[model samples]
Target chain A: MPHDSAGHTPIDMPDDPDARIIRALKALLIGRGFFSADDVRRKIEELQSPAPARGAALVAAAWSDPAFRAHLLADGKVAAAERGVPVLEAGLIVVENTPSLHNLITCTLCSCYPRSLLGQPPPWYTSKAYRARSVRDPRGVLAELGWTPPRGIAIRVHDSTADMRYLVLPRRPDGTEGWPEGDLARLVTRDSMIGVAPALSPSAVGRDPSGI
Target chain B: MDRLRFAIGQRVRIRDLPVPGHMRTPRYVRGRTGEVTQYCGSFRNPETLAYGGNGMPTRGLYRVRLRQGDLWSGYRGSGQDTLEIEIYEHWLAEVGKGAPDAP
Candidate 1:
């Protein structure tokens, strides 16, 4: 392992072959004038800046407004564009969680996540275990992920293909009536939106709800 | 035809054949039959796109809904447990095409 010019370890870089290859590719592209270092950095920052906040904002708005929720379920792209969330480029469908039916999203072939709405997928979502198990045994998979829906509620797993993406609109947690959109949004976590867990209950709010 | 061939509520089965190249259909749902819940518009085939093809020729896609019991034996979930997946047209065949009153 080679040290940096300042002779300090870069925690950003762990000894990974993929990182070394990417660095080499970046250097080659820069040398060939195909892209500047600033361009790469800007792109990296753009991807890194995308978080679950966008999805949470949309969910919060929907929870507070029935019209918005109906619009989101009817047409996700238009609803997302209306909210300035930037999901219109791809086909998106928002599956709502009903009293008797639960919705779970997964991409079995590869990690075809809804990057436009929720940013990158959580690491476990891309793992083979999740991809295979989610389709075959969604309830069991949900149990493993620390969420077990009450019995008798049918679990419907959506296996997303490259053409279309699915987003889960988890039922709003209890005891949040009359809550403002912003506060309701705070309770929406990425895992909840992915259907592996439920939106944080009022008791679980004001603390790190992510079990990870 | 790019337009959807399978009407909503029609029954179809995912082909279980071994494809030689790229494919978007997951193996787990292969050969399983399901009802067409929605008509997803046409799109370029991912199978060809993965191989760097132009992907110009599009195929119809549908949201197929199936019961978990149909896909797995001894399903542990409630009897009403169901699943849905977006599958391309070419991979499906109508199950009861000649039956009377078949939609």
Candidate 2:
């Protein structure tokens, strides 16, 4: 094992049993014509593309249609069942942000997310800093995510457990009413679902950077 | 290990196991009790060694619901609101029923 300047172990792995096993597996898999490291990287990039539109569509539909919103709140699994999105079964709860009591989700231990609704988690969602600080200091974590809750509004931080996963239903942005589902879907960004940012309005669209 | 089963509306206490590597069992609910509001289908436990330590697979997962009040006593929120979570069979035991005491 390689020691740091202070003679202490840093986060990097050494040529220990676990490292040897990973090296062996990598060699065997690469030799067997399986996915190379580059292939895996490409696959992840493909999955993380602008595919959030589908989930955005669902969120927009819920915002526009009260009946659909009821279905979504009542049984999110069945509401999203047609889309073939897998709902996390562990006493998983979906909390919608109302005019009051905004909710945010963080995986304190690991990134346990709703793959069915959001497809794939963003890079920032899995950071060790996010995992550790979210549970202890949720308000600070939200600030780091670039979200500043309004004064006098209480912030509720929900730490996702291994058995429980959480999804935040951000409030619909203003000036989006009577808009088409496709247009509204385009406004629903990944950051909105995580409660870090609000959904984009028609004017805010195309102003932000292209692609996730 | 036998296939564990519990009906909806039944209360169960979550257990904590010192499994090497990754596990889906959250540290907070290690010894907490919550009611089972749903009967999710079963498959091979993902917490098993075969599924890797981390939560990378969902083929053999079970979905369950837990009320917020049940999870935390004196929880202040809308009484109708409930939180749902997916837990593997290995992380649960029937409370005050036929299941053994959680260690």
Candidate 3:
């Protein structure tokens, strides 16, 4: 499990040529004058591990408890801290997804994400197209991500800066009442937290015919 | 640049700085009206004109709120839905407060 500065684990990436290049650079830099590349490499490695499943439990609890949901929305960092999610002091804002409103976040300038909660950002998120089009045409971006908000729903696009990170708290899906936290965690994908996708219900999971 | 300060509900305009490479300031908000909703502290300006300009170490950060109606006049959605964005100090200026007229 890769651990970041905040002690949160990130998802692992498949080893590829790019990964090799990163490793080589780490070795080259550490072998020279730059500060211990090994330390940096270790931190990066920790960031690549799958994030702890603890956050899932909080989401699940919020799904079943309206009070908790309100608390989560009122002060997400505090609520998550109570749940042991290790909310970093990076000036993060938790935007809630409601039936009438949808929120999408992008770092037009750079990739400033809530790594402590959602783990590493997906590849599609770092794409130039996603960044450029997110603010200009958010509805189109959401559509491309397979989310079509109901008519009359407003979509707000937030561009994260270098200092502030943003996270989207997706609305609790239907047919999830009485579901256990362990079962609910499986439904929360990183994309949902970014507002590019919605949380999956049991029926939707593994229901894709293409095996995606 | 020094640390920037502003309060919630204070309207400000984003500056159009000529920065090379990619920057966090979206082009759309370059000269748009936004209000400071949250105060984010200082941090390294990622857009560090790497090619050689100023070697500043840190920049101020703040979260500004832009109403959908303000951003898009034809925006047909709820007026309460506002987009909050984080911006560096160098990217903002007092609204209607023109830059000093060059002598």
Candidate 4:
């Protein structure tokens, strides 16, 4: 396999149009001293790194501290910054999921997401089926994802179509009243942060640290 | 900052223009009326930015909330269920009279 100066196999092996465009753009910028090949490599590695724990930490803090939760709902960027998590791109909006309401996030135009906090979105999140059906049939999509909100709770779908990215602050699970922040963080899964599922109940995941 | 043309709680309709090129407004919302729920601050217009333009004079962005039933016929789910989207000011037109309390 041939590799570029970045020391990684080319993303498009067979000279696809997208590969060609990216290659040309990288060469032009590098040739112009805009950035180095090292920068490109580092960026790719950074994106590939898994960082869902950062988002879960924020959610854990919000669930345990009322003040933090208020700040998160009011200004997600600041809340993330308070926790030392960087939200560099689009503005962040933390939507709360209450007992009577559920929130789901999607990007119909593209695969825009809170990558700075949650790292790369799941492949399923960027699929055409999800992008098309999320806004149209959110409940159906959630059901297919193995989660279905109760009849009394309404579902609200948010489309990140522009400059703002969304994160769902799922409701704290029951039977976790005295759980420490670290343990609470364990219950906050990536799917829960995306609003596809609720936080894991203590009974489901077990209170023992080893169970997680 | 460009003067904001729409306010929160005001009713507005998304314009369905046929201008081609990079756009953030999805086709599913075109020609649909919704309520402004938030003033999301202004940002560089992606349409101009995509084509190497300066994207000067940032545009005001708002989060509009539309009833799922209004957007889709015979929509299932609670009547209160809705969809929220971020839309630039240019794509929105004022609907009726003054702004009311946002539900």
List candidate 4 segments past 4 Å from native. Answer: A1-15, A24-34, A208-212, B1-3, B97-103
Candidate 3 C-alpha lDDT tens digits along B14-100: 777777575677777777888887666677666764546453767778778888677766765556656778888777788899643
Better of 1 and 4 by TM-score: 4
Segments in model 3 whose C-alpha atoms lie over 4 Å from true places:
A1-25, A32-41, A52-55, A65-71, A205-212, B1-5, B18-24, B41-60, B67-82, B100-103
What TM-score would each prediction reach against the true structure? 0.87, 0.62, 0.73, 0.88
lDDT of 2 at A181: 71
Chain A TM-score for predicted structure 3 = 0.76
Docking class of 3: acceptable
Give the local distance difference test score of model 2: 0.64
lDDT of each: 0.84, 0.64, 0.74, 0.88
In the range B1-103, model 1's lDDT, one tens digit per residue, is: 3546888999888777567667888887887889999877888877778788977688888899999999999888877888888888878888955222221
Interface RMSD after interface superposition, each candidate: 1.1, 6.2, 2.7, 0.8
Label model 4 with its docking quality class. medium
**Best-to-worst ranking by DockQ:** 4, 1, 3, 2
Q: Candidates' DockQ values?
A: 0.67, 0.18, 0.43, 0.73
lDDT of 3 at A193: 80
Predictions: Cα RMSD each:
5.7, 8.5, 8.9, 5.9
Per-residue lDDT of A1-212 in model 2, one digit per residue for the tens?
Answer: 86457966568868889999988998889889887978867877855553566567778778878888887767677776655555544433556887666676777666777765676887878988776655445556677667766644555555555444556677887766567777777888877877677677667785333232
> Taking the true A–B contacts (Cα pairs closer than 8 Å), what share appears in each candidate?
0.69, 0.16, 0.59, 0.82
Native-referenced TM-scores of chain A, all candidate models: 0.86, 0.72, 0.76, 0.86
What is candidate 3's CA lDDT for residue A89?
40
